[model samples]
Target: MALFDRYLAGQLLVYFGFFSLVLVAVYWVNRAISLFDSLIAGGSSVITFLEFTALALPNVIYAVLPVSALVATLYGINRLSSDSEMVVAQTTGLSPWRLARPVLAFGLVVALMVSVLGHVLVPLSRTALAERGAELSRDVTARFLKEGEFLHPGRGVTVYVREITPQGELLGLFLQDRRNAAMRTSYTAERAILVRVDGTTRLVMFDGMAQTLQVEDRSLVTTTFQDFAYDLAGLAGGDDGARRRDPREMPTPALLRADAETQAVTRKDVAKLRSEGNVRFSEALFALGLPLLALGFLMLGGYSRFGLWRQILGAVVAAILLKMLANVTETAARDDAALWWTVYIPAILTLALGFALVWRDTRGPHLIRPRGDGAPA
Candidate 1:
């Protein structure tokens, strides 16, 4: 029994690894294209792009593990059945439940890996990635300054620099601010400097003139000054202190023990945080249910020369339905904390279905009514 279990586990792991690698690569590449474009356009280095993509991998891995477990289990079971290994084991007095032990073990292994990613790695990666993005957006000197070209850093704001010195100086600077509908301002400075003050960026223009146009009255005002300051806090969507933290970036422990203060800065409310915390555990638990579900689907077919192709298709459909149910439950849970238990509905249904199938198989072949007038005379 131990040897057979080892063999089954070995087969499942091989398929699981293969499917996970392929899925992650496909997902990563699709995501990396967008990241590469955004980072490069923002004047970030290739190393920064690589780091951002790497940080995104944990979330992708977490998303793929349950599906990978389902595919690997289905493949392993179909291989054994096609090769008649399952039939030999069944005839030798091995029950359906006994055959499923190895599959259950495989499921548990996948569950552990997903748990680590969901509870730890994913949150850390997302937080780091967000911080990096915010930093890139705030890097005005590198991201916004280009000699002899007009740059629009944010909506309704355009800047043009005649030259950028190696000493980090901006010369022949032109700025236009139209963010305030009532007041339009323009500035032309011989030189300008970027400074950070009180966690916000300010453009300090030296020896410049400020021309203000009042849109309501069509009045124009001009002022001459040696120094002028323009607030840039809104340019990058806000500074680190002003940026709200996404719920996905919060640690599991924080979510579980979240207070009103903590919820204030997140995108969602307290109920949403609680629901998200429970979802992490539910997702991990669902991983342990998939293999059992797939094994049950395979066991129902016995050993047919015509093949268990129908059962395989049914298994795929079952997995899809389970995923849809999970998504619906998650959304409902987010809206109502009382519905948080819905997070476990899919897992419970899967386990129950698997158990029922195994019990039916243990009772021997099922009898069916004859069709097409070949009824039992």
Candidate 2:
């Protein structure tokens, strides 16, 4: 019994590992192609491209694990059944439950690993990738700003350069601020240099003229200075450091903390946060449920006399429906707690059906004995 269990486990694990690699490779190629345009736009180096691709692996792995598990299980079981190995084992008094034990154990282990990755590692990787991408964008922008063009640094601010020296200095700099409509402020400089100050980049102008236009009284005040600095608040606002932390980018513990903090917020904000938190929790739990689902699917595949292609088709359809159901339940859970009931119901149904099938297959053939020389009992 122990040897048979080891054989079954080894067969399933080998196939699972192969399919997982294939899925990961396909996803990586697709992502790299999709990111090609962005790479060009960002002027990314080879190292940057490689780093981005590596950072994206967690999301790909999370998406592919369940499907690979299902496919590998189905294939492995079908192969055993087709070769009559399962039949021989059954004749030797190996019950369906006993045969299923190793596969279920394998599934549980995979599920736990996936759960940890989905709940912990995925969020961290996503946050790091986003931050790095933002930094790259900022660096690219600072290097690529052209002369003789009006640039909007960020909201409510505009900068115009009449010319730029070959050495990359601004020859004629003009900046406007309409942040306060009631008091428009404009600065002009004969020469300016962009510099970083206190973790923020600013434009320092030499021999510049300043204008203050007051809309309340239609008044204009002008002043001239030998040296002046314009620290555009808009630039500061554009810093990626100030960006909102998306719930998906937060670990489970941090998400819980955030939910607690937002309890005193407005009702709308509370609903939004609760919705996000519940969905995250559901997805994390779903990773654990996948192996159970895979086991059920494997039983169906193994017992069906339909051709291998048809069984494969059925498994594919089943996987699609399961995913669709999960997504629908997740969407609902975000808006209402009542929807969580829908999430676990499918898992329960699948488990029950799998157990019933396995029981009937293993016991039905032995329950009734030939009676009275093939006559009625």
Candidate 3:
């Protein structure tokens, strides 16, 4: 019995890895395209692109694990049935519940892995990723000086550049500042350059005109200047080099505790923090429930040449419905921490359904009445 359990569990683990690798590769490539564009726009090195994509991998893997588990279990079960191995085991006095023991164990293994990622790696990666993004946001040349494009890097500020010289000069630059609703300012320059002086980023606009509009009196004032210096970091608030941390970037313990400092720094209320904390655990718990759920559904069909297509389809639909339920519950929990238990409902339901399905299989095949058309006695 122990040998059989080991064999079954080993098969599941191997298949889980294969499926995870394949799926992660596909998903990661899709993510890499967007990463490439953003990294280039921010004047990041290829190394930075690789680093950002690597940081993003943990979250992608976290998302893909459940799907990989489901597919792996289904594949393992279907293969066992196709080889008549399941029939042999069952005929040798193993009931469906007994056969499911190894699958349950396999699910627990998956659950443990997911728990580690959720509690540790994912948050750390996200925090690192966010820090890198903020650092990129501080590059004035990339954020504000892109040539032949209009950019809005801050609230009520617009900048445009017609061309940029290889010698690092801006030609035909335009700037509009409307942060002060009552008084609007616009600047246009035939040539300009960026200079850093005394730990400050300054834009030197040459041969330009400054136009001010008074909204209250409908009056406009225009003045020409030989050169004008503007403090760019002040415009985008990037001078401070401070970034707000997201709740998801914090450790689970921190989120659950949600001290006054955490709340003030993250700008999230206690209820929402608690709800997010619970969600991480509940989501990790799905790793266990999902595989068992797939195994149970696949077990419903006897060995057949055509395969367990109907059961596989049913498993997919069930997984989708359960995921939808989880999302709905998560949204509700966010509204009030008192509803935090709702997030666990899907995990509970999945486990129950898995057990129920396997037990039903143990009940023997259901009998059906003969068709009336036969009219046999």
Winning candidate number (TM-score): 1
Q: Write the residue-wise lDDT of candidate 3 on 1-377 in tens digits.
A: 88999999999999999999999999999999998886665445688789899999999998899889999999998898889898788889988877889999999888888888888889999999888776665666666657777776566878898998998899999999998989999999999998888766889999999999999998999999999998877663566645778998888888889899889878898878888899888877887888888877887744446678878899999999999999999889888878988999998999899988888777754421123434343
The residue-by-residue lDDT of candidate 2 on 1-377, one tens digit each, is 99998998889888988999999999889999877656644345677888888888998887787777777787887788789887788789987789778777667666765776678778788888888776765552353246676665454667787887877788788888888879988999999887777766667789999999999998999999999877643454455346566666765654445455444432334444555555554554554444445544444433434545554565567657767877776567556654545655445555555566566655443323344444345
Candidate scoring better on lDDT of 1 and 2: 1
How far is 141's C-alpha from truth in model 2 (Å)?
5.9
The list of candidate 3 runs beyond 4 A from truth reads 142-191, 196-200, 209-223, 234-237, 240-242, 367-377
TM-score of each: 0.85, 0.69, 0.83
Count of backbone clashes, every candidate in sequence: 0, 0, 0
How high is the CA lDDT of each candidate model?
0.84, 0.67, 0.84
| lDDT accuracy of residue 30 in candidate 1 | 96
In model 3, residue pairs whose N, Cα or C atoms come closer than 3 Å (at least 3 residues apart or on different chains), thus clashing, are: none
> Quick one: ranking by TM-score, best first?
1, 3, 2
Candidate 1 deviates by what RMSD? 3.7
Worst 10 residues of 3 by lDDT: 367-376
The segments of candidate 2 whose C-alpha lies over 4 angstroms from its true place after superposition are: 140-193, 197-199, 202-237, 256-306, 337-341, 363-377
